[model samples]
Target chain A: MKQQRDSIPELVWNGNISVEIHQKENSLTYLANLPRHSYFAQILEDLKRLFAPKVALEECWLSSGKASIKWHWPVGVLYDLLSQEDPESATSVPVLWHLVFHVGSFPSSLVVPMGSMETFRTCFFNALKESDYVRNGSSSLVIALSKPETDTYWNSLLNHDFYDYRPIATKLFTSKSRIIPLKIYLGADAPIVQSSASLGYTLGQVLHKQLPRLFPSAVMYSLLKPVLHGIVLPSTVSTDIMNRDFCYPDGFLHIVLIPIST
Target chain B: MASSINAVEDQLSKTLESLQTEEKSSSLQEKIDEIISSYNEKENRKVNLRFKAIGRTPLLRKNVFAINASHRFDKVIRFLKKELGFKPDSSLLLYVNYCFAPAPDEIIGNLYDNFSVDGYLLIYYCVNVAFG
Candidate 1:
């Protein structure tokens, strides 16, 4: 008797991004008394310098057992940074830093599937291609040349006289892990709600809304939930949350939130 | 008294001789030969038998063996060894339902009797190797 074969493996991403800003002089006064504030302020300054005057900076936090943040500066800013001839600009250049942050006691010897790498490369290149400014410039021509041949293409892009992109610095920090728990913290000026039911209901609204938009063919709730919950969150976030506990049978890494304390 | 005993013994010996002659008249070997010849003729007219092996393992087994005809057995074996750490000395077992058979050493011209699926040749190996 013949048996049915299994489905192909799929790669997924999960994470979130947020942006905040403060007046430079006021931030300096506040940072002088508070060390933590100063640290975060320096990070914001460094990000502003890299992204430059016209670029928007977004905060992204990713947790896949391990949490990490990656700040992708705008292509125009990167183009400017690379082309600057000033000595001060060269001196102020940040180190090309790449660190894989591991948190929550997850193992370090985790294996990431080759398929996931391909998926990431495709998504990243596609995103770059879609940028209008990038597509119109001489840099765009270089990017086009670097499109999807091999690792050599990426290496060449790095060495090209167009952009200075580097991986983010990451460090592991411990915090109380949340299960499927939903907590609503309202701001002081908000109106008192007659029902708290509506508050918790919208917690997953963004995820639910983005699911179909991100993956149009995701029809079944069962299939959608696992893939969405696993890949969507960590990839979107600025932090790199590399989970080492699970492996998908289809040869991909599994990223799922377990009930830590519920 | 002597004349009476001799007459009785002579009648018993004649009865035994008649039974032996009757048994020899029937021929059982001729009937068996005729049945075997007819069965052989029917099989020869209907079905064709073929055999295939990879790395000294016959293809017909309980496991669904994926086989490729586009490449030689040596090339396939070399690829497997290079990519998947499969050794030449690994035992290959083939079985189909309750029937089981192993490939012999001299398999160069053994009917080329295997099916191919999706450009892969499937053979049951006694040694466990990862398959994609």
Candidate 2:
């Protein structure tokens, strides 16, 4: 049991998303494995150095096809949201995320700005504050975090240090929260479905509550399944366990709904 | 193929529109139907929302809006922005209960069911990030 529990963090924290960022003007391609929990802004400084004289860090943004990647969401959430796969397809190879790095024409309406560390910190904290509120019914705990605690917490997420983030999160979470902070992504065109559910609820209960029509009660088998941390969850999976063990550093469970093979 | 992305969106919009169309005409059959239904749908009807301004956000002269139960929370945010004459670039945050901005896409009906009191979904709004 100890080994099983230990593997959860080891698997989640070390999970790398293989990213391929291509330059449009020249065919120069930059390939690297991005940490699933790190935001694009956290890694942009290093990426900008590769093309420093040509493109500044503040001027850079990544896109998949025409969709403007929301920089504030964790890189893994972006991958789950923007990409789709045929479950029946025979190939078992992992997905290599393709992104285009552009220097100009930042679409302010579509995506928020994250050019500076301050902007990134503010956005991250704002999201964290909201998630904490959903879990604890107040943002006081997050606001009360000391300067060093705040820095360590933020750096742990950016650095993908699950061990460093664990204790601080434990201090904040304190107990099994009544309401689980959760965001459900349906599709690209559809806006995200962010609804709070109780800690006692199972995956099936939450699904049926938020999306009853899609996950019809009359149907014996669900036509749709929820994916978290790049793995599909069983209907009986406990929301509390998932929240404690697999939730993102921001304290919210990011779930993606995809069609299951009938 | 039967359940494409558009299928779900269409169902959601139709449910919202149907609730709005028959908002006031809550027939006995509808009440019975809700009771008999296997799933506990929040309400097969609309919600009465009252907006309260906070932290320099302008108060709405006509604060109450009968929002459909199926509409997402983003609609409320967009409506507040347009009514308040906020520029497209401006930021407006909405909160419920006490001091947390629920995600913009939260369904209005769910918020009403979970947090409403006295049959009014009292939403608090701010022109800036006031809570944190």
Candidate 3:
């Protein structure tokens, strides 16, 4: 009986595994029917396989009484992996590089967390400064304010507009331009407004009649104008409106019309 | 001399009968050839000719029309019928290359350029015509 007991593998009481260093408390816990040493070895092996063998595990600790283990790995390995898979994951990956390499033309709108616009703009400008395309005069950058802080900013820029600032590839970037109104709905529990369906219907009607006249010069106007001209009320808006019991659907609408440089 | 004359008459009759049969067969063959040539010409023309109707204009040109997601056939069909006063025939076969074959009622967006249609990356949408 003693010999049989000794021959059997000792059980390892492993607790939590947290991938993100920031979320150590809410880690995933697991119990493997293997010895403590072997369990640690398995984890190390898994890490080694996931990251290359060049990824060195710094430290690993097993709790005294609790079935928990804590480990730390290099941040460089994580950054490289994240950048390769998810371009938007890290703030360091230049957005212009992605725009140049991946998407040839600029998108109509880039939705980000509401408060992070400044940070995003700064990073975008920095990237443009470093990029070879901009340096070599292949492309130019222009920033137009939707609303000038004061008349002074506009007046100053307007004085030397031809000399100091010039249009890029016949494309103008300005926020002051009027956009087609889009109605968005938020649901009660959902992130969007609930009444967006009605808004979308109304917008669709207006656009169906008006779009052809608006974009007559566009080659695929018949196909694209009607769909794009109307206001979009996504389901996300529906949920938010319902949850908040917001009556003024029009107030929540965001209408920004801007031209993009190709 | 009498036997020779009789034999000559018999040979002449056989030759006349054969000539009549040959004339009928030749006429039938000529008709068949005409039909076959007509069909071949139609097939060739259908393969070569195409047509396109631009915008709300009532004019349709004898030009090839290629279809792409960018062309938005579903949206264009509605516009063409309702606004442009053009109706597609029921027999109008909608063909896309294996790469460009879009699903029925697929709402195409700007992102279509990123992907392929049928099997070929959708460069353009063209229409071919065959008149019998």
Instruction: Specify the highest-TM-score model's number.
Output: 2
Docking class of 3: incorrect
Tens digits of lDDT, candidate 1, A1-262:
1222221111111111122333323332111111110112124334344334343323211121232222222221111222221212335342322222222332212221112223334433332232211113111322334333334434423333111211100000111211111111111111111011111222234233322221223232211122221222322321113221111111112222111111
- Writing each residue's lDDT as its tens digit, candidate 1 over B1-132 gives 112212322442343344346555433332222322332232221112223333543343332333432222343344433334446545333321112121121121111222212322233333332121
Question: Which parts of model 2 are misplaced by more than 4 Å?
Answer: A1-5, A48-59, A86-90, A174-176, A217-221, B1-132
Q: Write the per-residue lDDT of candidate 2 for residues A43-109, one digit (tens) a residue.
A: 6766666644466566777789879876778888888777745334476478788888777798755
Judged by whole-model lDDT over C-alpha atoms, candidate 1 comes out at 0.24
DockQ of each: 0.01, 0.14, 0.01
lDDT of 3 by residue, B12-118 (tens): 34544465576765443343233223322222211111223323334433333334332233543443344334464421222222112232232232212223233
| Candidate that would win on DockQ | 2
Candidate 1: regions farther than 4 A off:
A1-153, A156-261, B1-79, B82-132
In order, the Cα lDDT scores of the candidates are 0.24, 0.70, 0.25
Model 1, position A209, has a per-residue lDDT of 31
Q: Which regions of candidate 3 fall more than 4 Å away from where they truly are?
A: A1-119, A122-178, A181-262, B1-132
Q: Against the true chain A, what TM-score does chain A of candidate 3 give?
A: 0.16
Model 2 lDDT, full chain set: 0.70
RMSD in order of candidates: 33.3, 8.5, 31.5
